[model samples]
Target: MLSQPFNPLPLDELTAVFARIKDLLLTQDKVDRALEVLVQAVGDAIPGSAGAGISLFDAHGRGSSIAATALVVEQADAAQHDLGQGPCLAAWTAGTTVLIHDAATDARWPLWSEAVASLPVRSLVSTPLAAAGGPIGTLKVYASLPAAYTSATGQLLEKFAVPAATLLAHIQGPGTPRHLSGPLKGALAGRDTTNRACGMLMERDGLTAEQAFHELLRRARTSGAPLSRVCSDLVDGRA
Candidate 1:
């Protein structure tokens, strides 16, 4: 519910912005780095944005802030995760865009709003990162001014969502390119399996996302096996 009137970017400017993003995407070597850069791009592309962050949900729906332009953005996302509420989490879980004109006066998530009210953030917008199955994460931009985001801003962000989700899925999915070295391919597979295992643990045992990840690492060490193998075994119910 932004109070400000929507200001659409001129077609030429919007085209150039996307062109720059395409170049940035090509330069990224890793999914994590790509997501970080994408959030930075969002901050740069949109007016009135102070910072940006990516909120990723594991398969079990537990949210974690993967990247942020500033410490305040990270803190704000963390508050939402800790409280089990916030626009980012809502966007990810519900697969919809969310906007908070002013967190201090936004009554939908009172606890989350109150918690982050002390921070420098005033307005926020979160868009769902839709994957093949559904939304797997959220892309969020924070502003220090109230009513900073408008309908045009939301539309612009929606255009970026597809590419962002695709990049993440490419890294985590099983279809590694044949050009990658054997070791590198194995490393990516291991990371993806570990993430899946962590998600499974969270859902089955009601553990927090961080706790589940640590548990996987500890079990892998105790079993004297590669983390990937351990995760695979867990997924197959063999461990």
Candidate 2:
């Protein structure tokens, strides 16, 4: 039998949680560990989220899949790469939260609609990871049921945007010489490769890093290729 779903946090408790979340984000240490902490906290903080993922876009416009729980982010990333639709892309593009309360019935992306219906992703909330200039990428959460989030919940996630953006900027900023910091320190091993791939596309196609990365994701989806493998081939001159 299916287990009963988790209960929503009461208003008082939710307020306290947001307070704590705010305090944590204000700290340099906590900001550094934002990615890891986000995934761990999202499930408990939000009533419907089964998992979450944080994607960071580097200076060269390449995306590094940093923190992820289960396959929610991974598959969502794939869907973005594949069909070029969904809340993640919207958030990244708009530099704001993209709320899809009903994926199956939404007319936003017909291709994504059919694809996500096959998965357990009935609802989604994607908040942009921004910096001083604009959006860097997205922090996305997935739920198995539609209309799982309320306006309050969406507002809560929005409250997280400023701190989250600051954290990302600190780590990947041009002013910072350091490569990794806080929670993103040991997240992925292929970051350099992804960067190299982005650089190659920039050099060869005269595309901006962001444009190149988007193109790479587009290619990966159209050809049904894994992102790392695609980057490897680009680095090795095979693709």
Candidate 3:
């Protein structure tokens, strides 16, 4: 007979877990380190998660493993990049979450599904990292058992996604010569919005970085708006 599904964590314990994650994000100064911590937190917080990872897209939209709780997670991400389609990529492009109950039988991404069949992963959930400009990447949890993630697990992960996005945006933004303190960090976060907006345009329209900036400039000029405002609109999809 098959074993029972994993039980969800207690509400109070879940809250405490998130509190610790918040502290982790606040204390981390580097993006890479922050992502490493974030993935570890996911593995710790979610029930039945064998591993967790962050898959980031470069300026050119090439996906790669940024961080992972284990080597299995990294290899899983690499398999998706190799196949050129997977739940994580779908989540990033659609700006929503994607769940696979069992990769061995999932037909949505046939190539990716077949490729990962030999791995320990059976079920997975990929949630988009919604930054100020748009979705920059995905946070994914891998499970060695089928039907591993439940509604409660998904909800918990969703709650974590918000601050995860902000922390990631701050890390991807331009860095100061010295460690930022006080209001400078907030100001830099705002600037990163524009930078991310430009990146989105470049990825979407196949424009060079300079061309992307000019496009933003052209839009702002024609619409009689500030560059930052135009970028914010683009980032938030008002443009």
Candidate 4:
């Protein structure tokens, strides 16, 4: 329905919107309730967005929490998990943004596209929810119309993802870990991953142990990402 260029909220207004989400984070006691409200606000706030969803995943990429503004969106996300391929999962695993202009006409994930063809889910943008060490999952917004989201929309969504993820990282509720779904646990896992990544850098470039570590630091600094995230990218062969 929307063919015009997408103009997202101004930076100041957008910050105010996310500030509200942050406030919700502090007021609510239940993670699920806060998540639902947050998702609904997100869907309503973004122009042309039919729905919004947030999915949290463990280190192994299994979902730990999932919330959506509408049932159709819930089903759409479930299809991604069931089919094992979709924009959100791609964003989560790759620690990058995934934007699909039209799932109906041109789908990079043909299987998932076919699965959700009957639903009002065509254009969407998903961004990895990056935290202290690495991405914890993804936050996505969906639109019913083809080409509903433009490149600018994707960029805005990425900007929105940063603070959104920050609030989510601090959410507390029943069965929710106080930090990053268990910061200590994630840190321990990150340590192992970091060690293996250091080894990979050492072997790949024939650098000394300290030199390899410095290289990892350099990558983290240049990329403006966390060291553990840099290590994860290298270990996952994405760096």
Candidate 5:
């Protein structure tokens, strides 16, 4: 969609949209909420986008789903995890936007295309969620039909990228840790899996928390295993 001839946008209009974002951020409860707004803003900025979602990576290189407008985010996440390729992954890895106006015909990620075809999706665009250290994740947009997103839309998404990163940084700060579920709930947050694995290792081997964690990592590297798998093995007494 972005293949068309370029047309310049006026500065006043750009500043106006940014000012509105500033106002929304001020009223938001936290950085995550602000990022939701930022994702929605990307949709509003683009003409054909039906929805948007944001994901962020932790210190462990694991990316978690944050906020999403619909099931498209879930599909996108699955595609990235399963196929290990897609706009979102590329955006995060390269710290740059990856825009694909048509997924069905795209050769970049054939497995991703086949997997996502069943979903009500077509065009997709991803902008790197970056900070001082580099990319943490992606801000992804989805359209219901092919060739819907344009280069202009990609640029607009880029404009909001910094603010999205800032909000994510705030949410993932010293005070807030990423949890998959709430405290009252049995759901695990960011370090929950790691904690559980450490506990299991400790119980099985009489090691300290730090020692167990290091052991898990050491075994994972030595055995060429995934940390999550090592954790599971410890939990299930299979390691």
Candidate 6:
């Protein structure tokens, strides 16, 4: 099933999810720190949130450069990636928003919810980072209270994700993201192989870059496998 959908929050009603980037303009090395600031700002603005997090998904749907406001929040996000199921990944794949109003009773992701039950994340709302290419990641908020997030909260998150995705795309260009922790380094290492596979598809099928990417996304989702693996198979002529 697709996730819940909503209109963007009005400009005047928007909050500080994208805090001032005064420090961001200074250096590229601070990109991760700036993302942390954004994540913290969103959590702070929420009334009953335990924390907030932003995750950029790689080919495997795992989070990279994940920034969370609290340790439990980080643990909960890690559980989602480790288990390969959760609101964030669901939202990203479906290109919609997911709200686990109460994780205790939410059966949509039984394994993910059960895995993080020991943590302080009783509720969660995550919105997709819908970019021009497709869903590249997600931004999520966690709360210790059941039903902590409402439609209004979901709308606010959608607003936050708009610019968050844009900022992430810009910083991921060549020569940027020199230090995005370590996950990004791994993604970068696989960039060449992915590009080669994409190029092969593009030339062989007359597909544009975006179309080639969508085809790869289709294959990855179909095989229930990582994008990296899908690309490798294609480059190795196994698919």
Least accurate 10 contiguous residues by lDDT in model 1:
179-188
Count of residue pairs whose backbone atoms collide, per candidate: 0, 4, 0, 0, 5, 0
Model 3 residue 189 CA deviation in Å: 15
Clashing pairs in 2: 32-182, 32-183, 33-183, 60-209
Tell how far residue 192 is off in model 4, in angstroms: 7.2
For each candidate, give its TM-score against the true structure. Answer: 0.65, 0.59, 0.65, 0.71, 0.65, 0.71
Reference-based lDDT, each prediction: 0.71, 0.65, 0.70, 0.72, 0.65, 0.73
CA displacement after TM-score superposition, residue 62 of candidate 4 (Å): 1.8
Look at candidate 1 and give me any clashing residue pairs: none
lDDT for model 6, please. Answer: 0.73
1-239, model 4: which lDDT tens digit per residue? Answer: 57555567788977877676666566655566666767776676678898898877554333433678887778888887676567776776556788888898764678999999999988999888787766777888999988787777778778878887777666545567454456424532564576578689778889754456557766776888877788898899898
Tell me how candidate 1 scores on lDDT: 0.71
Per-residue lDDT for 199 in model 3?
A: 88
Model 6, position 65, has a per-residue lDDT of 35
Residue 169 in model 6: lDDT: 64
Task: Choose the strongest candidate by TM-score.
Answer: 4
lDDT of 1 by residue, 54-161 (tens): 776653334677779989899999998777677887676456788888898988788899999889888988998876656667888899888888766778787777
What's model 5's overall lDDT? 0.65
lDDT of 3 at 225: 80
Ranking by lDDT: 6, 4, 1, 3, 5, 2
Clashing pairs in 4: none
Supply the TM-score for candidate 6.
Answer: 0.71
Model 4 steric clash total: 0
Candidate 3 lDDT (Cα, 0 to 1): 0.70
